[model samples]
Target: MAERTYDVMILGAGASGMMCAAQLNEKSDLSVVVIEGNEKAAKKLKVSGGGKCNITNVNVSASNYLGDEQLIESIFSQFSKEDLLLWLEHRGLKPVLRKEQYYFCPKSSEEIIEILKAASAKSDYKFGEEIISLSKEEHFVLKTKKRKYKAKNVVIATGGKSFGSLGASEIGLELAASLGHESISFLPALAGFTLQKNAFWMKELSGISFEAEVTVAGKTLYEDMLLTHKGLSGPVVLSASLYWSKGEISINFLPKNNLVDLLHNNRRLLSTALPLPKRFTQAFIVHLGIKDRACVDYKNDERALLVSAFHTYHLAPAGTYGFSKAEVCKGGVKTETLNSWTLESNILENLFFAGEVVDITGELGGYNFQWAFSSGVVAAQHIIENNKV
Candidate 1:
């Protein structure tokens, strides 16, 4: 059979790939084909944000991400959270702002997925087809198990190696490496941390949650934290994991209250005397080997020790829950190899990278989705505008 030909071939059909295809379909006459290895498109998209799909954040800025700050700033300038919301509204997928930070589809992720599918309906979709080999000569050649295609341009949006159950892969980074690009080692971000021996008592409090502040790597985030059977999780812990490459994390369980004063003058047991959860306080007090005595019964040194412990509970995590539980990867192909404006490879004229496959990784609460959408749109528009050249 004769080899197929197209002007552009987009690998992966996740958030970025589908977004790019949709934009190209509307603005350019270039023949586009989206290849996805999964049985369906946007597998992760369908389940993101517990199916509601936090598409972006209302307070998106370059500060909310980790990567080349200049590149992220440039992309957000092209498509801000406001732009994403407006674009969704225009496409009939109304997004609701929640908690003054997250933008979510009121219905489900399917709402946005359907809009993207409809917008890119003109483009061909090859589901269950994975590109096995890619080479370049006069043009770009992509070979799958069953067929081969030649295209003038290609876009890599294969995403990161997180959530492998949803079909995440490293092919996008691998492709970039083939073209002489620098890639950063990927680490699981936005995941729970497993506690070491000293903090193993936390595991017994599984299912318990509290409002607190977690600090690591000189960065702090205040949110709800949950004690899991494995270790620590929830919003605060997940966010802390973004900045915590390793070492200890400090938790302020009583961030809102001054427990030291209350504890010093208390007549009740340490567990019930403080404002923290009774179970947690009891377990912590016992772990510290403090006698359950009246405040006056304890010496000044003991009071100070208890106060210091409450204010700064240090925990050394053994590791993380790994990629299976990770919401995103922290690194990818370095941004210096790609043009900040177009996300195009500096060495290859028509090759481009976008979304999580790049070194840019956003914090929790929909920042990652926004980055994917913005970068994909920017790359798509750039490719179309320069197609005639």
Candidate 2:
């Protein structure tokens, strides 16, 4: 019933909204407000990188990304690992690199949250406001469950549907539709696959893990393999789910070594290079249908058959855990309607989209968070530059 006022109001206090607020300095001369529907910001952040919060990746590049390829590349080019490292340092947190693959907070994801939260110090926000509608006049009127707040500009920084249990839902996409902005249907990415055919091995080997090379179609990702009660998990399979994964994927239970060579060496000396439990190894050998022929006694065709099994193992996955277990949602705001440099909506002036709400979704690791941060920064700066704030 009463009218509240502000200069800039951002919707969704997830990674992008938080980073967007953080980027607007106290000197911006405009009042900034953030409306969040959740109890706290970045509920997903708390568990990222298994609580360590892989804050960013040192190998961030267009090649490692999916979505609107050109737009993603253009936007990310404006921010680099250096910028993020400096940003973290400014927040008094250091990002540590692990094996040229992932960068993480040395303390924990909670520490990363502390840093980003510190960055939002200058901006004001409503932590429990659930925005229901918006109307733009000379100023924008934002309707939430509790009240109506007016602002000159609004940013849809709510993330995509990933883990609904953690507040990852289709709310952003629905809001975009309400705003007259087009959004792409989203699918779960970075999730493990569950097979239609129950894998007897998975149940038998529920607690087993091994270093493995998993390939789907032709793409390959190498990492540790974990056996779950339902199916397979771990870094390699999760990443593989991004691209090669579909109805089925080919997995090399044994990688980088021919069965012939391994057998040849281990058979005569009775040494073991099969790094799994002896029982599992025996199972593997049995599944390959290789009975006790001495490794050298194998005929050429038998050697070839053994080689194929070790090199190309495959099975169809029934489905995934869907959004609740996904690390990132795959699709979002159709990239064709956005300005890469500014993240401005092509159909609507003074309305902007950022973070996972856009079609640009990144792979597992801190890449998605970094994209959220960079995109938010670009959108806020653009809004400011255009005097929309």
Candidate 3:
């Protein structure tokens, strides 16, 4: 029957929410509180990067991101990569770099969650609470099943609408609307695609991965392309998946070697460079009904055409795995409605937004998590500086 009030209440206790709480609580005057739907916070944290928790990335810049790229530049400037490295080091976390510029904790992801909780306990308020409805009076009022809480400042660290199994959703959009705000369209990002019609080759060559370039149109993919039982995956395909509205993606079966060179040099040895899985090699050379003709087997003009085709393999995906498997959602509350530097809502006074809940989405590697941490820090620091309860 008692009303609980705090200086700051953060929804969603995943990466962004936790960072906001720690930053606020570290300050002397603030009483930082986190409301999480899950019985335990950071369930998504444990599953990220296959439980290693890819925390951030190296060599990231505004160009590596999508969405309102211009506006996102200011946000990154506010909380730079150096800021993330400094903050994580302050928390006693040393991350290891993985392939593809990803940075992950050397320990298990559970350790990452524990580190957050430990810092949160220092001065932050963390309640195992789920908010069902939210409203505002002179101050922001949050309603849970059991009680009501008023906060001087409210932060929607609630992540984007994706990965429902891990409790990701668009609840923040509804909450923002309740307070007279508009949100952006939501889409799945960095997820695998399914085909409307089965590609028989997927069954034949399910797990083949090669270190090669994936070019869509004229742009070269910085990541590798992998063949899956369902479809193509890996950084390049996932990156292309973001821009693919509706069409086939182009892929090169061989990256460095020219089909002509393979043919001219030694038709039989072409397989050495691709080092393709036995099954995929069958599809490319044997099952295709080409034998000794190998690379050199074809005449000059004919070899040229085949080499070009190999570099540009077009594919149309059925659809993505949807939110359930997405690493991050593509869209959220549009950037125009919120302050890029502070992530505060222009429509709602004392209201802030950060993390995947906004339209900004990053390429795979640790960029998404880095965005979450940096954006949350900016929002919390801004609230601490600009607002009073």
Candidate 4:
């Protein structure tokens, strides 16, 4: 192995790593290099947003994420949602906004990946190189399986361990710990939930979906709830999983209509009167231990029970589907240890953390990618601005 020197060495050529390398190369004459373990870069980004790549959300705020709220807010302040869009458009990556405010590449995820590759064309990328260890002595000394590299600054853009099959690992976390950074325990977030044995009835409602509101851990989201053979999923369930540490998740099966009023005047069967899938209604009423009697025959108490069942159906999940099915991990290196603006470690000189590897995990949508890109840009900007002096 030969000794190589560079201005900065970024770990993991994912979203943040690519962004930082591209911007840094563009702004200054700094020699930058990206180290990746996988055969190709941005494997996760290539599969994101169902292959279309949700670039960023039109609406982003401090409340759209979980972690050090102050740190997250300050990061966004340096790089806002509009700032990201302008940067993308300036780079000729025109994205389309759909499903309300989510920005996605109309062609495919490859469009965004291509743009990133082009942007970072000047930076050297070493794929299939796994980082074994790192140490700082005047300059950051990083060791990989294939070679040794030294740099003035280091950026750990390796994402959280979500899709292990895509080559995600805990190396970033381990490296951060080695450099004296705090971390919150990692858990599967934005993933499906396996049901408890008590609510095994939900399995029968597999393939059935309804637009409902789900609440867990004091946060509520209104989106499509999907019933699966293993458990619950879909937009709302996945969103709720981010907040669900451990507790019962409540759902409003009928959020759009007042089921009680419909039940008061109708003689229709309990399964037929309410606005829900017949299969779901049948399973729900049966699980409630109520026969499919005419809705009008129910007394006030019975009606109340029905209302409660519809409005506040609570079930404790056995556990999440794990990192294999998670879109992102819920935790990472603690925020207090890093400078909120530059993402540089407070205690470690010229060392920074960015992307999902940091403690801040955004909600489902493009918030995660935005955080990655923004934090990466922030770190690179600080380096570029300071290097000029």
User: For each candidate, what is the lDDT?
Assistant: 0.88, 0.76, 0.75, 0.89
**What clash pairs does model 3 have?**
248-315, 263-295, 263-296, 293-297
Winning candidate number (lDDT)? 4
Clash counts per candidate, in order, are 0, 3, 4, 0
lDDT of 2 at 115: 74
lDDT of 4 by residue, 141-220 (tens): 98899878899989999999989999999888899888888788788999999999988999988999989999887788
Each candidate: RMSD to true structure?
1.6, 2.4, 2.5, 1.3
Give stretches of model 2 more than 4 Å off: 265-277, 292-294
State every prediction's TM-score relative to the real structure: 0.96, 0.92, 0.91, 0.97
Query: Which pairs clash in the backbone of model 4?
Result: none
Residue 196 Cα positional deviation in candidate 2, in Å, after optimal superposition: 3.0
Once superposed on the true structure, which residue ranges of model 3 sit more than 4 Å away at CA? 122-128, 196-198, 216-219, 267-275, 285-292
Q: How close is candidate 3 to the true structure, as a TM-score?
A: 0.91
lDDT order of candidates, top first: 4, 1, 2, 3
Best by TM-score: 4
Please write out the lDDT profile of model 3 over residues 307-358, one tens digit for every residue: 6656765667888777777788877787888876788888887799988887
Please identify model 4 stretches exceeding 4 Å from their true place. none
